[model samples]
Target: MPSVPLHSSATPIVSAVLAFDVGGTDTKAGLVLSAAPGEVPEIVDIQRFRTALDAQRPGPVLVDFLDGLLRRYATEHPQLRIAAVGVTVPGLVDEQRGIGIYAANLGWRDYPFRAELESRMQLPVSFGHDVGAAGDAEVALGAGQGAENAMILVVGTGIAAALYIDGRRLRAGGYAGEVGHAMAPAPDGGLQIMEATGSAGAIGRRYLLAHPDFSGGAREVLTLAKAGDTVAQRIWAEAIAALAFSIAQAVAMIGISKVVIGGGLAEAGDELFEPLAKQIDQLLSFQPRPVLVKAMLGQNAGLIGSALKAQELLSAASSEPSTGALP
Candidate 1:
């Protein structure tokens, strides 16, 4: 049987949640309706906007873009009232205070994103880390839905992981996940960092640089290996080994029951997961083997997760006992 496509609907919920997944180059926006705690929520509307966060005034530029989007959403769907908003952004985020502490690519520091959105739309808002939000989405509706404990490692241009113990997220001052940045002995036996040698992005770049004759990219590297390119094969093997090393160590230390991987590199499918699982199994002698799986949600996981977080905030605000605004 073929997989069914999830179609967006406009069914009204007790409270509607508007979500945004802001990235370095693009921003994804969506709305969740008819949501509840632990419910398999659905996105009512989803759209994307170009966001060149690499510019200088990324905050104001993003602010204007969001402002326009919100107004358009309201005008297009006059029947649905947005009860709350959630925005997930890359970089070090202080979600508790709704601040984007530092976004290297976006050039943001101590950005008050939640306040800006709330003020503009006069609605409650929530903020979250991009990878962490995606991880949360996986835990709620993807691979870790029924698990007691789950670790979601997002392997992309960079690496990060989200730790879910029980139903709650673990935010260690908003810096709990930075797996790619973890320093490891350089594969070349030099002073290079772990990510320089380990991440899927690094693997692709390394392979391409070493062999200009080969087209560059993760998929290209996999193809080259399949065609028996010795260097490509060695690079691919080392990349998988590095990931397995990191994951194995994480399993031993965190006692995670399930691991879901997402990101650009994860696109290699079983080519990446099968080898990773085997390597991890071989490496971990005493630790229990955690089930490793690909993320059910694709690149849009962050957007979906942000929508869920917004939905939660919306529900919370709608149910709270009324209190008069302080003069």
Candidate 2:
């Protein structure tokens, strides 16, 4: 876990907020209370629940589960009032509209997520994409902090990126950072998406395709590569090359000063970063090379980001005049 930073001595403490990060397999909830006003909130009562298995009816089930979690939290902490609620979910999310456009893993489509949650909970709701929210947290408090421009890439089952430039997140209507789908040179002398060649899932599939007798995943393939397996080495090298190509392209296009990589594969540490940095260096001529760093927040980044969003909602509401009307 990354160390939480303290606020300046001048600010005072404020109210609490509720936050949830809904993932494909699990949902994490936290109550965030500020140690001081205008400071990073201290997260408390953090809990994780398994996501509903009924994909056919996940929306209602998820909403009910969230309601239950919130109720339990409120009951336990009667002294703390939740000003707003923030929820981050995986998939094609329209944060501005608070609609879950599509989530193949969670099996939902065009769900009015924010409205439903707010209607039931009677609180302001902040909804956003999981990766985007995580990136925001990274920029605000983790690896990408202090950089004027940066790209945070989460390489898990699939690959995606959160682009930050000029002190602002470039959402581009939620379609801007789909780096996995970007075109790259395929092994067969044709164009292919970066995820199809370099993602963890892709690496596993490639290994299986080359050696049908093997029954291991990407981790095993990587171990074999390190131990001098020719096929594993070739597959790993190709994936690295494709990823480097994509990073070089991003650097050329955005002039990002930093690239923070997270997720399971980043655990490889030097093995992944050293080669990737070298490849990117070789690929770029006059372009300034971006420094590559590992993610500092681990898996809790999305949850922290949700808390930040909740705080943002609180701030916005505080600035608005009370109409004696409910949203």
Q: lDDT of each model, Cα atoms only? A: 0.78, 0.85
TM-score of 1: 0.87
> Model 2: how far is 237 from its true place, Å?
1.6
Model 1, 250: alpha-carbon shift in Å? 1.2
Worst 10 residues of 1 by lDDT: 7-16
User: Which lDDT tens digits does candidate 1 get at residues 1-327?
Assistant: 987658646555344667788888788887777645666577767888887453677677677777778778777776677766778998888888888888878898887888887787677677889999999888888877887778898887777888876666778777877777776556766544556766878888898788777667778888889899998888888888778877887778777778898888878888898988899899788878989988888777787788777766755655779843411
**Model 2, 1-327: lDDT tens per residue?**
987678555544346778899988888888987645434557888889897646777788888888888889888877677777889998888888898888878988888889999999998889998889889888888898888889998888888888888988787766778898899999888999998888887888899998998887778889999999999998888888888989999999988779999877788788899999999999898999999999988888888888888778777777788733433
TM-score of each: 0.87, 0.86
Candidate 2 clashes: the total is 1
Q: Which stretches of candidate 2 lie over 4 Å from their true place?
A: 1-15, 35-41, 53-58, 76-80, 211-216, 321-327
